[model samples]
Target: MASKGLATKRRQESGRRKGKEDGDKTRGGGGDEMKAGGGSSWAWKTKTENAKKVEALREIEQLEQKINNLDREKGVHLYNKRSDFRKLFCTLEEQELKLNSDRKTEKAKLRQQLNKMRGSVTKFQRELHNVKPTPEFVEKLKEIMETIESVVSEFKEQQKQIYEELLREEQTLNQEVTALEKRLESWASAPPITIETKSVKPKTVSSARNVIADLPPEVAAFERFLLQTGGHRGGWDEYDHGTFLRIRNKFKGKSAFLDEAATSIPGRNITDVRQHENWYQEYLTLMEKKKDGIQKWKIVKEAQKDECLTQAAVDEDEKKEEEEQKTRARARRLEEERREQADRLNAWKVQKELMKAKEEEKQIEIEMRRAKEYEKERLRQLEVRNQVQEYLQRKQEEDAIQRLEVESKKAVQEEEKKTMSREERVRFLERDQRRLEERLAKGKAKEEEQRKKSKRLERLKGQVEVQVERDPSRLYRLTEGWKERKKDTTSASNGPVLHMPHRAVPSWRAGL
Candidate 1:
């Protein structure tokens, strides 16, 4: 029994080994088949799989048959559509040709009409060109223009004279107004005279008369002379005293001197010198006593005269200023009138120029139209010449191609005459195959080198990535270095460093 069990175990072990060997052989055979058929091998397919393939092939054949029927129908339909399209295309082509012919006829008729119109325009222009104004007519026109100018000048002169008269009246009225205003100002500025009872001094009219009557005749005459000469009495005291002494010396002992003085003096009547000697001597004594009063009176009179002279001078200056203002106004008006005349003349010249320009523009337009027509004809001729040249060039190119083709054919015939034998051709082909194999080997080597280079690049990229991972701020350091280099370069070129102001943080963002 033990022997039998051992035999059975050994047989089982052999069977297990055989089964493993068979599985390995089967796996190896599958691999070999896959390699030989590029993984599409069907030699080991099961019956069911073969059946499925046949069924699929049958379905494909049925689909192919249906597709062939659809293709035949589509072709028949397309043929019918093509026939209909060809008919339509032929009809359209016929219509197009008819339309083109009609258009050509109409274009020819319009061209002829345009030519006729152009000829008429040319004839009219020629006729007009020959007709010019006579010298007499031109002279008459000039005379008419001059007459019109003279009339306008006369009108302008009358207007200017009227304007001057008005200006003069205005100036006079202004002067009068100024004088009235000055008087008003003076009245307004004058102090009011108030009579107070405490300041009043009462005197009888007879006393005033007696004072006047008591004055020496010579003194009175000197006063009258001062009034007539517009002289103040400030310095008149010396004159009066001197005159009194002179009169006294001349008429003290002579009656004839008094008579002559009375007759020579204005509005004086002295009958006897001996009869008036006592009163005259009394008046001289009174005048001598009132010297202080006379001095005061002289000062008051001088002040009055000075005030009057100042007022007169002010009025004169005002008058002179007014005259100057009027003169300036007149000059401005004359200048304005002259400018208006000049503007009128300029306007007339501009009008004449505009008329001449319009005539010239018309002439230029005619010339331009003629030139355009000539240019159009020239362009048409150029187009015809260019077409001829292009046709000739195309013909020459075709001839050159034909010649090249003939040369190539002759070369091919000569090569055919010198053709190698089959063995030699086979040897040349083998040589070319060997050369191709060498080129393929070189290409494979180049590919290997490129792969090695790519692997090296990949290794370098991995090292750089590991380095960057080790130091995360390396990029920032690089950027800072680049910025420093740029700054150094800029500083070297610009010669100075510009310090920028530090940016201020907003109050809200200050903490951040």
Candidate 2:
């Protein structure tokens, strides 16, 4: 039984062992299958991660390709733009350089022009510097310039006269026009059969008289001379004087235009001139008196100082006298009046010198004006003479041309008359030739005479212009001076007319 049990146990154990093996194998295989499934899941996760990475890589590659395409397309355009900017910069730099160069050139030219003008001024000054004037020279120069000024003034007067004539003409024309217009209006307003008689404007009569009643004797005499000889102006007939008098009559009373023109210079009246001179003389006299007073005061003060200096004398009597004298002369106030007078004198002297310098300058200016006028006159005369000569030459040439033509015509006619045996000739040819020659000769002589007359007229006109421009009165020429101390032998020539020395009402300051 023990033996049988052992065999069964062995078999059971063997079977058990076989079953365990089979189970082990099955478990191992199942475990292996599970592990394999787990590995597959892990691999699937890895594959998902790898797939995402691959997709990301593909996107990166596409992006890279796009970028490359953009770079290729844009690179050329950017390079071309940079090249254009570089060229433009260089061109701008060149233009800026050219402008700077041009500016420098212009500045140099302007500098040169300025330098040339300065040089001309210097030269003119140098030339004038060497010509020192003599004492008489200044006087002569003044005379000449004054003459020139006079001539200029005369021309203006003539121009004024011409203008006045024009005004008269214009007035006449307006009157005629007004008359014509009125006639037309009357014709238009009247009945068709009725003749209209237009009324004439009344002739205006001026109640004013020539204000020459208060004229000085000299002025009166000059007026008489003017009336008697018709001004004796070259080429001006007696009729011209009548014309002048008519024009002059128009401005009998004070006119604003004439007054303003006359008073352009400050205090520009004859009376003012005399007053200024008197004032200056009085000022000089006062200064002299002040100087003399100062001198006297200085002497007195010196005497007082000497007395003070002697106050320290030793002798008893002298000391007593010195003390008494020192008491009278106080050192602090001793020379006060003298010092005051001295200062006043110095101030006065400075003013006097200034006034003197001003007077001298005025005189100098007058002289220069006259000199310039004289030169101008001389030049004018030369020009006039040249013009006359030129005219005469031209006239002679015309006459010669006419004469030659006449001679040629005559010779031709004479030659042609051979055919007719001198039986007939053209009428009026010889008479006409003679008349033309006479006309030419007369014209030449008249031209020369007119030239001379023009000069005299110009000179007279110059005098009138200056006198009138200064005062616009006949009295401005010193023609009515009544202050002259008359001598019995005073001639009735071109001199100032004096009135009886009664009393002159003092003149008032202007703009008072």
The best candidate in terms of TM-score:
2
Residue 318 of model 1 has an lDDT of 59
**lDDT (Cα) of model 1:** 0.56
Stretches of candidate 1 off by over 4 Å are 1-397, 400-408, 411-512
Question: Which ranges in model 2 have alpha carbons more than 4 Å from their true place?
Answer: 1-334, 375-383, 415-512
Q: In terms of TM-score, how similar is model 1 to the real structure?
A: 0.16
Candidate 2 residue lDDT tens string, 1-512: 12223233333343344445445545444464566768676566556755765675576568657756654443333323333344434444454456546546644653454445445444544544566568665665566556555654664576467457655544444433443453345345533331111243533332112222222333333333433322233123345334433433555523332343234334345444333334434444544664565466456656765655444233446545665877666443336644764797799999999999999999999999999999999999999999999999999999999999999988986675566543333334766788999999999999999999999999998888553355467655443345363545457765685765864332321222
lDDT values, one for every candidate: 0.56, 0.52
Q: Highest lDDT, which number?
A: 1
